[model samples]
Target: MKTILLPLLIGLMLVGCSSSPSLSNSSSLYQELNGQSGLERLVDAFIQEIAGDEQIFHYFAKSNVDRFREGFITHLCDVSDGPCEYQGDNMIDIHTGMKINEADFNRVVELLINAMEAEGIPYRTQNKLLARLAPLRPEIIHR
Candidate 1:
């Protein structure tokens, strides 16, 4: 009876493991976002929306606009488990001397949320992306 019970338990555990989600592969999420092509669309839409917003866009305009835009997309893609490498400066050094206050950061976040919404990214996905990006706040924020 003990031997029979142990085998049953192992089989159940194996079944459970097979049903669990793969933590490392974000391919499913990428597919939900419409894959690589969708990434391109989302990046383009996000940049356009942010650029049109005067408050945040001005700050961006003063900085390296092209590099900033490209870096943002690269970071997003890398975090989302896409096949892209982020080759930008460290967040802390990049944001240094910018004198970005909390209010400015919040405003940029709002614009980013809007852009994500415009792209029809679901709340769950947005939250997942935000969770990944949140840690960079300390490095990106100054003043």
Candidate 2:
């Protein structure tokens, strides 16, 4: 009975696995982003974008640029499956008191998109990276 059940379950699992198209391999997204130096450039560009935006600049006015830069670089790297681990505060903890509204949060996203464009990341790759990071929205926007 045990042997028969095991084979039956394995067959069902194999059928289920093969039923859907597999997603693209995401492990190398870090390399696609051009690795460490590219991530640094992205962070720097994002910072500059935030600095230049009137509405969004105020949110980062009192924040330390160096801290933000390093933390963001690490976070991006980790999310893209790079070698670095994120060592910064969790998103919720860092954004809890910010009272960030949806519009402002979206503006920040737009700034990030702009930064990716500046870094010459292809549109499809940008979408891939954005999808990887999209789960952080709830943690960041605390109403």
| Candidate number with greatest TM-score | 2
- Taken over the whole model, the C-alpha lDDT of each candidate is 0.77, 0.90
The per-prediction tally of clashing pairs is 0, 0
Q: Kindly list the per-residue Cα lDDT of model 1 for residues 16-132, writing each as its tens digit.
A: 988888643535556666667777777777778778887777766766657766787777778877778888777888789888888888887787788779889888877777778
For 12-50, candidate 2 gives per-residue lDDT tens digits of 999998886654553488888999999999999999999
Task: For residue 1, give model 1's deviation from the true position in Å.
Answer: 22
**TM per prediction:** 0.74, 0.80
Name every residue pair that clashes in candidate 1: none
Report how far off residue 47 is in candidate 1 (Å). Answer: 1.8
Best by lDDT: 2
